[model samples]
Structures are given as C-alpha cells and as structure tokens.
Target: MKKILVTGSAGFIGFHLTKALLERGDTVIGYDNINDYYDVNLKYGRLNELGIKKDKVKEHQLASSELYPNFRFVKADLCDREYLNQLFKENKFDYVINLAAQAGVRYSVENPQAYLDANVQGFLNILEACRHYPVKHLVYASSSSVYGSNTQMPFSVHHHTDHPLSLYAATKKSNEMMAHTYSHLFNIATTGIRFFTVYGSWGRPDMALFLFAEAIRKGEKIKVFNHGEMERDFTYVGDIVNGVMAALDKPATSNKEFDTNIPDAGSSNAPYRLYNIGNNQPVKLMDYIEALEKAMGKKAKKEFLPMQPGDVQKTYADVKDLINDFNYHPNTPLEKGIGKFVEWFIAYKDSKLK
Candidate 1:
C-alpha cells in the first residue's frame, strides 16, 4: 500500500480525498491544525465520519481510525517546522498532498497575515520537508482566483495568472512558482491543481451553496452578489478527487516540446505541472440560486447587491489539459450536484439543531 500524507485532511477537499485514498487500500497520515477558520465542529464532523473521535485527538498527536485501519490523523499546523520534520522522519510519506491553507477571499482582505503565514510559510515548510525526505510526488491546491482580473473566458492553465486581485490568489500563484522552483532545484515532482468553485455535500459553510441553502431554509433573504450578474464554473468535489488521484499516479515529467524562449505557464522542462480541474460550465448566479430553491422546495427572498470587493465577475475553466493528460472528466451535472448538496444540507442542518 502506498503511504501518503495529506495535509488539511479535515478540510472539504482534503477530507474527501483522504477518505477516498483510504478506501483504495492506501495507508494515509491525515494532518490538520483544525483551525477555527470556519467552524471547528464541521471539521470534527468530517473526522467523525472517518471514525476519528475528537475527544481523543490532541495537538501534534497521531491517532488512528477504527473504521479505516489504514487511516491515521495528526493534529498539527504546516508552519510548525520541527514537528513537521519529526513527522516526516518517523513516517516516510510516498505522496504528499498539501491542502492546508487559510481559505476565503474576503477573509484574506481583513486578515492578510493569515494568508501569508498559512499559505506561504506553511507551504514552504512542506517543500522543505519534501526536500529533506524524498517523496514520489507533491500535489498542492491552486485556485482559479489566480486568474483574477483576466476577462478571458474558460481560463486555462497555460494562461497568464499575473493579475491576481486578492492576497489569497496571490498566495496560490506563489505556490505554483515555489513548486516550480523546487522542481527545478531539488528535482521534486510537483503538481498544482487550479480548482474552480468547488462545491458539494459537507462543504465549507463559507461557500456560496451552503450559505444560500441556509438563508433560504431560514426564510431569510439570500444576497445575490453583483446584482446576480456573476457566473461560476462550479465543480463537484468527487470529480476533483479523481483528477487528484490520477495526477498522483503519474508524477510530473518534463515536456520535451517545451521551449524556454516562449515557455508555457502550465508545464516546463522541470518536474512541475499545473492543471485546471473545473467543470468548464459557467452558470449564472441567478440560475444557481434557482437550482438550490428548486431542490429545497422553497423560494428564496432575493436581495440584489453590488459585487463585493475581492470578488470576480465570472470563472470558467478550460479542462482540456486535465482531460488529455489525466483522463479526468467532471461529469456531474450542475443541477444534480446542487440537488445532492441541498439534500445533505437539509439533513445536516436538522442534525445540528438536535
């Protein structure tokens, strides 16, 4: 079995990916600080599903799950270098997936330092640890937000991501650069995924779908940002996991056709690669809200609002490279995905009240 280390295993994408890996018979060490970025209870709830008891977990402690014997959990932050080194030394991880970051664009606006500490410094530590302890591949999360201010439709990995509008986007773009540097200097196989607006069951409450569902369920007015003029390439969490696993199976390799004179931003001669894992379907904000309303069997009190700061007008991803390379196809229909999310939200909300 492949021994893997997945940071931010308590987070939405990390949780799903970790669970999927464990189910596939891989031994996984799940690491997360479990910070109160959104809701610690939600994080713990995900761990509970993985058979990890919150009462038994402690900072820097290693806990194994009863349900999945191959799965282990570590309560630690990425910025803690010494502890991270110790973890790497004790358990040599074949695959390292770094998903621990201070997420949210608006949150980064108010708390810029948090982004630097977690996204920048934290990721640096991961690279350092991988440098010290050789891993087969290092896969990290990048965001479509990195394409900020680019009015181009269907943003591709080969597109220029130099015009990031938010600190969060800047940090993600920095991760790709950092990964490329490490790949060149240390020969580490690093793959970065630029995820579009990912949404699904047990997703972050800060996400649009969860917030919209909660507001509609409470009979409260749901704020339509940009006066419902926005569009998003909402991708399901399951398909993203598939793409991630496929990439992990095949480590990054140099592109022989790559020309340094006019180099591509996605891949290079170094063992570094970038791919956009999105649905490639940009749905309008109004249509997304309507889908949720239909699934919940309720009408939302709409409150038209101007676009907030650090927000993009639209995000449509070009997944041609992802499909051609990894054979990864996100087949989840937008309406069907929304229905599944709505179903989970209703049950989850009811359970939380009790």
Candidate 2:
C-alpha cells in the first residue's frame, strides 16, 4: 500500500479524504493544526471519528489511530518549516495531498494575514518539503473561487484566473502558480484540483448547508445572499474524494502536444495539470434551501440580504478535462445529498446535546 501524507486531515474535506485512504488500506499520515477557526469541538469530533483521542494529541507529536493500524496523525502547523522538514525526512511518503488552508471568502476579508500565513507560506513549506523528500505526486486543493469575477458559466481550467475577487481566491491562484514552478524546476509531478461548492456529511459549519440547517433548527432566519439569486455546483464530498483518489493514483505527465507559443492553462509541458472537480450541475439557492427543508421536514425562516463582498454570483465547473483524464463523474443528486447531510446534522447535534 502507498504511504500518503495528507495535510489538513482534521478539516472537512481532508477528514473525509483521510478516512477513505485509510479504509482502502493505504498507510496515511494525517497532519493538521486543529485551530479554532470554527468550533474546536467539531474538529475534535472529526479526530474522534478517525480513532484519534483528542486528549492524547500533543503538538509536534505523532499519534496512532486505534481503529486503523496503518493510520497516524500529527498536530502541527504547516508553517513550522523545521518540523515539516523533519517529518519529511522521517517519512519517505509516496504521495502528498496539501489541503490545509485558511478557508472562507468573507473571513479572508477580515483576516488577510491568516490566508497569507496558511495558504501562501504554509503551501510554500509543503513545496519545499516535497522538493527535498521528492514525492511521486503532489495534489493540492484549488477552489472554484479562483475563477473570481469571471462572468463565464461553467468555469473551465483553461480560463484565466487573474482577477480574484477575494484574498482567499488570490491565495489559491498563487498556489497553482507555486505548484507549476516546482513542477517545472524540480520535475515534481503536481496536480491541482479546483473544487466547486463541495458539501456532504461532516461538512464545515461555516458553509451554507450547515448554517441553514442550524438556523432552521433554532427557528432563526437563514440568510439568503444576493436575494436568493446565487447558484452553486454543490458537489458531494464522496464524489470529490473519489476524484482526488483517481488523481492521486495517476501522477501528472507533461502534455505531449503542448505549445509554449499558445500555452494551455490546464496542462503544461512540465509535469503539471489542473482539473475542476464539480457536480457540473448548478442548483439555485432557493431550490437548494427547498431540498434541505424537505430533508429536515422543517420550513426555514428567510432573510434576503445583499450579496456579501468577495462572494460570487454563481459557480459552475467545466469538468471535461477531469472526465477525459480520470473518468470522474459526480453523480450525487442534490436532494439525495441534502438528505444525507440533514440526517448527519440532526444526529451530530443531538449527540452534542447529550
């Protein structure tokens, strides 16, 4: 089994990805700072699911999972270059997945330095470690928000992502550039996955799905941004993790037919590639809310509000490259996904009450 290092293993997508890897019999080393960006209990709860006792976790120390013998975890920040270097020296990892970053567009506006420290500086440290340790493949998370102010429907990997509206988006775009540089200079096989509105069980509380559910449960009005005109290609976390695995298994190769004269943004002559892993089906905000309402069997109080800054009107992914390269298709229906999330939310909330 391949030995993989998954950064941000305590976060939403990272948690799901690490669980899948462990279940598939791969040896995984999970790393995360477990900061209080959201509820620390939720982060601890995810660790608990991974068979990691929160009390046993200590900074810069490795903890083995009780359930998965092949799984181990370390509570460490990515910016700790010395510890990162030491970790890489100790573990000759076959593959690396960098998912650790300061998430959320609105939060970036309030705390730009957090994005710089985590997404920019932390990612640089990962690149450096990968350069020294030399992993077979390095797959990192890029967001559809990188599309920024592009009015284009179905954002393609080939589209220019120069006009990022938010600091978070800009940082993600910077990661793509950084990865390309490492791939070109060091011949590191790197792939960037641009996720579009990923949601499912154990999702982040800051996301709309969880927020709306909590607000509805508390008899509070759910905030409808852009006056309910927003749309998102709400992909299932299961589908996203599947796509990630598909990419991880296949290291990026130089595009044989690449033309430097007319460069392709999606693929390069170097061992670098980018793909958008999305549902390819955009659901309107109101319709998404309706699905949640149906799942929970509760009507939501609505509060229409102006669109927040650094937020996009809609995001639809053009996953043709992803399909052609990896045969990945996100098939989870909106209603079905919502149903699964609502069930999990209720159980998790009730468990906390006890």
Candidate 3:
C-alpha cells in the first residue's frame, strides 16, 4: 500500500480525498492547521467521519484511527517547516497532495497576508520537503479562479492565466508555476489540478451553496453577486475526489512534444502537467440558486448586488486533457448534487442547531 501525505486533509475536498484513499487500503496521513477561517467544528466534524475523535487530535502529533488502521492525522500548519520535515522524514510518503491554502476571494482582499502565508510559503515548504524526502508524485490543488477575468467560453489550461483578477487567483496561478519549477529542477513528478467550483455534502460554508442555503434557511436576504448574472462549472465533490486519485496514480512524465518556441501552458518538457477537473457544465447563478431552492423546498430572498471585488463573471472548465489522459468524466447532475447537499445541510443543521 502507498503511503500518502494529504495536506489540508481537514478541509472539504482534502477530507473527502483522504477518506477515499484510506478506503482503497492506502496508508494516509492527514495534515492541517485547522484554521478558524470557517467554523472549526465543521472541520472537526469531517474528521469524525474518518474515525478520528476531535478530543484526540493534537497539534504536531499523529492521531491514529481505530477503525482504519491505515489512517492517521497530524494537526500542523503547512508553513511549519520543522514539523513538516519531521513528518515527511518519518513517513517516507509515496504521494504528497498539497491542498492546504488560505481559501477565499473576498477574504483575501481583506487579508492578503494569510494567502501569502499559506498558499505561497506553505507551498514552498511542501516543495522543499518533497525535494529532500523524495515523493513518487506531488499533486497540488489549483483553481479555475486562476482563469481570472478571462471571458473565454471554457477556461482551457492552454489559455494564458497571466491576468488574475484576485489575490487568490494570483496565488493559485503561482502554485502552477511553482509546481513546474520543482518538476524542472528536482525532477519531481508534479500534477496541478485546477478545480472548478466544487460543492456537495460537507462543503465549505464560504462557498455560494452553503451561504445561500444558510441565508435561505434563516429567511435572510442572500447577497446575489453580479446581480445573479454569474455562472460556474459546479462540479461535485465525489467527482473531484475520483479525479484527484486518478491523477495521483499517474505520475507526470516528460512531454516530448513540448516546445519552448511555442510553449504550452498546460505541460512542459519537464515532469510537469496540468489538468482542469470540473463537470464542464456551466450553470447560471440564478439557475444554481433555483436548484438549491427546489431541493430545500424553500424560496430564497436574493439581494442583487454589483459584482464584488475579485469576483469573476463565470467559470467553465475544459476537461479534455483530463479525459484524454485519465478517462475522467464528471457526470453528477446539478439537481442531484444540489439535492444531496440540501439534504446534508438540513440534517447537519438539525444535529448542530438543536
């Protein structure tokens, strides 16, 4: 069984991916700061699903799961160099998935340093540890936000991501570049997966779906950005998890067809690759909210507002590369995904609110 280090394992997608790997019999170690960026309880609640008790997890210490012997967790910040090095040295991980990042667009505008600390410095730490410790593959999270203000029909990796609208987008774009540099210098096989709008059960509260659901449930006016004119390639969490695993299993190899004269932004002659993981189905913001309303059996009170700073008009993913290489396809219907999320939201609220 492969030993994998999944950073940000307590975060939404990271939690899901960690559980998936363990279920497949891979030995998995979870690392996270468990930052108060959102409700810390939600992060702990996710750990509950992995058989790790909230009380048992300690910072910089490894906590083992009784149910899953192959699973363990360590509470640590990504920028903690000494701790990261110790963990990597001890584990000798076969795969390293760097998902830890300060995640939010508007939040970044208010506090850009947090993004630099986690997304930039934290990423550098991961790359350094991997360079020294030597992992078989390094898969890090990128975002469709990197497309930033690009009104392209579908944001393809081949298109230029030089124009980022937000600090968050710029950081994600930096991650792709950082990964490429590591692959080039250290011969590290790196795959950067650009996630589209990911949402589902146990999703982040900061995301549109969760915020919309919470506001609707409370009968509060939800701020509809861009006056509900926005759109997103809303991909399901399960699809993203599967896609991540597929990418992790295939280590990047040198691209012989790559030419420096006409460089492809998606790949290089080095052991570096990039793929967009999304449903490739762009849904209007109003349509998405309507789906949630239908699922929740309640109508939303939308306060239409002008586009917020660092917010994009729409995001559509081009997963042609992912499909051609890994045969990955996201088939979760929008309604079905919303139904599951709504169901989870209701149950979660009932359990927590009471």
Candidate 4:
C-alpha cells in the first residue's frame, strides 16, 4: 500500500478524502491544526465518527482505529516548518494531497494575514518538503475564486486568470504559479485542482448550505447576498474526492511539445497541470435555498443584501480537460446531494441538543 499524507484531514474535504483513501486500503497519514476557524466540536465529531478518540486530538500524532490499521492522524499546524520537515523525513510519503487553507473569501477581506499564514506560507513549506522528499505526485487544492472578474462562461483552465478580486483568489493563483516553478525546476509532478463550491454532509459550517440549514432551524433570517441571484457550480464532495484520487494516481508529465509562442496557462513544458473539478452545472442561490427549504420542511426568513466584497456573481467550471485526462465526471444532482446534507444536519443538531 502506498503511503499518502493528507493535510487538513479534519477539515470538510480532507476528512472525506482521508476516509475514502483508508477504505481503499491505502496507508494514510492525516494532519490538521484543529483550529477554531469554524466549530471545533464539529471537527472532533467527524473524527469521532471516523473512530478517532477525543483525547488524542492534539499536535504531533494519534491513530484512528484498529479496523483500518492503516490510518493515522496528526494534529499539527502546516506553518510549522520544522514539524513539517520532520514529518516528511519520518513518513517518506509517496503522495501528498494538500487541502488545508484559510477558506472563506469574505474572511480573507477582513483578515488577510490568516490567508498569508495558512494559504501562502503554509503551502510554501509543503512545497519545500515535497521537493526535499520527492513525492510521486503532489495534488493541492485551488479555488474557483481564482477566476474572479472574468465574464467567461464555464471557467476553463486554459483561460488567463490574472484578474483575481479577492486575497483568497490571489493566494490560490500564487499556489498554481509556485507549483509550476517547482515542477519546472525539480521535475516534481504537481497537479492543482481549482475546486468550485463544494458541499455535502459534514461540510464546513461557514458554507452557504450549513449556514442556511442552521438559520432555518433556529428560525432566524438568512442573509441572501446579491438578492439571492448569485450562481455557483456546487460540486458534491464525493465527486471531488474521486477526481483528486484519480489525479494523484496519474502523475503529470512534461508537455515536451508545448509551444512557448502560444503559451497554455493550464499545462507547461514541465510536469505541471491544472484542472477545474466542478459540477459544470451552475445553480442560482434562490434555487439552492428552495432546495434546502424543501429538504428541511421549513422556509427561511430572507434578508436580502447587496453583494459583499470579494464575492462573485457566478461560477461555472469547464471540466473538459479533467474529463480528457481522468475521465472525471460529476454526476450527483443538486437535490440529491442537498437532501443528504439536510438529513445529516438535522440528525447532528438533534444529537447535539440531547
């Protein structure tokens, strides 16, 4: 079994990816800082569900279950360069999938430092460790927010992404560029996935689905930014995990015949690549709210608000290259995905109250 190190394994996407990898009999070393960026209980609750005990949820290490026998957890910050280097040296991981970051777009506008610390500096450390250790493939999370200010329908990797509107987007773009440099210099196979609005069970509480569910349950008015007219390519979490695993399996190779005269932003002569792993189906915010309302059997009190800063009107991913390379396709319907999320949310809320 190949050893894989997954950063932010306690976070929404990371948790799901780790579980998926373990189920497939891969040896996974999961790491997360367990910060209070959202709800710590929720994070621990996910670990508990995965059979990781509460007492072991601290820095430097713990194991989850005897059932897997191949799963380990490390509660550590990515920014700690020394700790990261030590982990790399000890584990000698074959694959590194980095999903850790300061996630929200609006939060970046308020606290840009968090973005720099986690997304920028932390990622730099990861890149350095990967360079030193020589992983087979390095797959890191990029954001669809990097396609900011572009009027292009269905954002494609081939398109120029220089006009990022948010600090969060800037950081993600920077990661792509950094990965390209590393791939060019060291021949490291690096694949960056520009994820759209991902949602499902055990998602972050800060996301729209979780926030809307909580507000509706509490009989509070949900803030409808952009007057509920915004659209998002809401990809299901399962599809994203599948795409990531596929990319990891197929390490990027240098496009030796790549033309420098007409440069392609998505692929280079080096072993670097980027893909847009999204639903390709943009759903309006109002429609998303309606779906939640139907699932919960309750309507949310709406507080219409103007579009916030660092927010975009729409996001649609063009997954042509993802399909061409990995035959990746996202098939989960919105209603079906949201139904599962609502079911879990209700059960989780009820359990918390008891």
The regions of model 2 sitting more than 4 angstroms off are none
Model 4: per-residue Cα lDDT over 239-314, one tens digit each? 9999999998999998777899999999999999999999999999999999999999999999999999999999
Q: Which residue pairs collide, candidate 1?
A: none
Write one digit per residue (lDDT tens) for candidate 1, span 211-254: 99999888999988899999999999998999899999999998
Question: By summed lDDT, which 10 consecutive residues of candidate 3 come out lowest?
Answer: 148-157
Inter-residue clash pairs, candidate 3: none
Q: For residue 22, what is the lDDT in candidate 4?
A: 91
C-alpha RMSD of candidate 3 = 0.8
Mark the regions of model 1 whose C-alpha exceeds 4 Å error after superposition: none
Candidate 3 positional error at 72, Å: 0.5
lDDT of 2 by residue, 136-239 (tens): 99999999999999998889999888999999999999999999999999999999999999999999999999999999999999999999999999999999
The model with the greater lDDT, 1 or 4, is 1
Best by lDDT: 2
Residue-wise C-alpha lDDT for candidate 3, range 1-354, written one tens digit per residue: 899999999999999999999999999999999999999999999999999999999988899997799999999998889999999898899999999999998998999999999999999999999999999999999999898878877889899899898999999999999989999999999999999999999999999999999999999999998988988899999999999999999999989999999999999999999999999989999999999999988999989999999988888999999999998799899999999999999999999978
If both were scored by TM-score, which would come out higher, candidate 3 or candidate 4?
A: 3
Rank candidates by TM-score, best first.
Answer: 2, 1, 3, 4
